[model samples]
Target: MTPTHAARLVRELSQPLVSGAFLAARDRERLLEVLPSATGETLDAFAAAAVAVRRARIGDAASLCAIVSAKSGRCGENCAFCAQSGHYATNAPQHPLLPPERIVAAAAAMARRGVTRFGVVASGKALPDAELESVATALAGIAALPMAADASLGVLSEDALARLKAAGLAAYHHNLETSRAFYPSICTSRTFEDNLEVLRACRRSGIPVCSGGLFGMGETWADRADLALTLLEAGVFSVPVNFLSPIAGTPLANRPVLSRDEARRIVVLLRFLLPDRHIRICGGRPTVFGRDASLAPMAAGADGLMVGDYLTTSGGMPDADRQGLRRLGFVVAQAG
Candidate 1:
């Protein structure tokens, strides 16, 4: 697409949202058609449009979140970018599920730093019945903090979800990781449909869903757009966008990290497609942008962040992140 054509397309997309109308599905398809070739001035136009849409839709109240890797390592799946996958022999931490107190203690620390959502993430295909009880206990403690207690405990049955929900589970996170077409290339143990069912269960159970994908895994722009569209179709309320950090000993160990411009454009693209959803920058923020420019995605259009240590990588310091977001003119999302 020509620069002028891309500019006009972005303007057209924004004008509808400006006038309080939703973007047409056909226009989103048109944006996808030009997204692969978007660069230079076209990328700039996309970011500007994304910022406008984000401001109009969600304002400047930036959301902050953190996660506790409650149960780590020995993952049954072989996702290519994960360090904790049992299929790979990396140096990621491994442990049984932590006690409820430890999980709540971690959540409390982050909550004190202004994190309003705390997720309990595990590494297995699904939380075993025994671990579920422990996590349920943790959920109650975290909920007592009056924070949103989320979980990413793989594919769970609807019964399991109901149990957690009763224990105060506020949302469930299960990343599709990539597009359906490209999903098999990264993971053979599970299908894209398997992940979608988890989201479906969340919807059926009346629990909010937080789902998105990991970019920079040698996928095409088409794959990225497909994942975003799938998340939208699934009706996920929050989209946690993760760039690949490329762990050693995994299949994608040698894959290059996404360029800063490309990463920012990915955020901008999601903000456009998911105009009303919480477009949160998660796991790969520090890996892709480092500390100095860690907040770049926020400037590009993301309004939520997963602060503090990631599952297997260093993350932005919670206090520092709060200060940084304030400097960027964002009011950190307050506690409930």
Candidate 2:
């Protein structure tokens, strides 16, 4: 399509599109159709429309989801992109599950930093019953904090999920990591369906699901689009778009870094697709997008962010993130 035609297509998409059933069919179709035509100004216009839609749906509110790697190292699964798993022999910290009080203290610190949601991330295929109970106790200890709590303690049974809910956990995060067809290439221990079932269990237990995938993991554009659509279809409430930060000593250590433009484009497209959801710029935000990273995504209508350091990487300081949000006229939503 010519630039003029692309501009018109963007304008047409920018209309006050319905986010519910009224435009569901058209919404998906339009997103798919405009994706190939996505370019510099055209992508920006689509992102602008997405931001407007998000503002209409969620207003100026933003959620701060903070995460702690409660248990680190020796993960049974070999997800090629991760540094925490021992399968690749990376220099990840190998430690046993932290004490409940220590975990609670970390949550308290995040609460003081104005984070509304706290997540405990453990590296493994699944936790044993004893370990799960320990995680539950840690969550319960942090329950009195005003912040909402979540845990990515690997897959869980119905009873385990219920235990977590009872312990004041409000949500569970388990990224499919990639599309179904591409999943096996990343990890052999778990199927894509296995991850989906965990998400389903969370939904059935009335817990909100936060799931998304890693980009630039040797996946195609179609693979990336399918990952986003799958998250939408799974009713994932929070979608974290993580660019693959290839860790040294891992299988993908020599992989090339994703370009900033490609990363920004993916975020913009995701915003257009999941306009009203919490499209969080997670994991490799700093390493991939650099300092000006947050601007385009926030302007494109991201509703939340994973603040502080990631599992094995540093990020922008909390003050910097807050300042960025303020500069963009986005208000941070405090815990009630």
lDDT of 2 by residue, 1-336 (tens): 776877787656655453432235565577667665577877777667777777776678777778888988888888888898777878888898998889999989888878888898898988789898889988887778988888998889999999999988988999998889999998887789999999999889999999998888898777877788888889998988787889998878888888766776677667666666788878888777788665556776677888888898886666678777877778885433
Residue 3 shift from truth in candidate 1, angstroms: 5.4
lDDT of 1 at 182: 98
**What would the per-residue lDDT of candidate 1 be over residues 201-285, giving only the tens digit for each residue?**
9999999999988999998877887898889899999999999998889989999999888898889878877888899999889
lDDT values for all models? 0.88, 0.80
- What is the clash count of model 1? 0
Number of clashing residue pairs, candidate 2: 0
TM per prediction: 0.95, 0.93
In candidate 2, which residue ranges exceed 4 Å CA deviation? 16-30, 33-37, 334-336
- Pairs with steric clashes in candidate 1: none
Question: Residue 79, candidate 2: how far off, in angstroms?
Answer: 0.7
**What are the root-mean-square deviations of the candidates from the true structure over C-alphas?**
1.8, 2.1
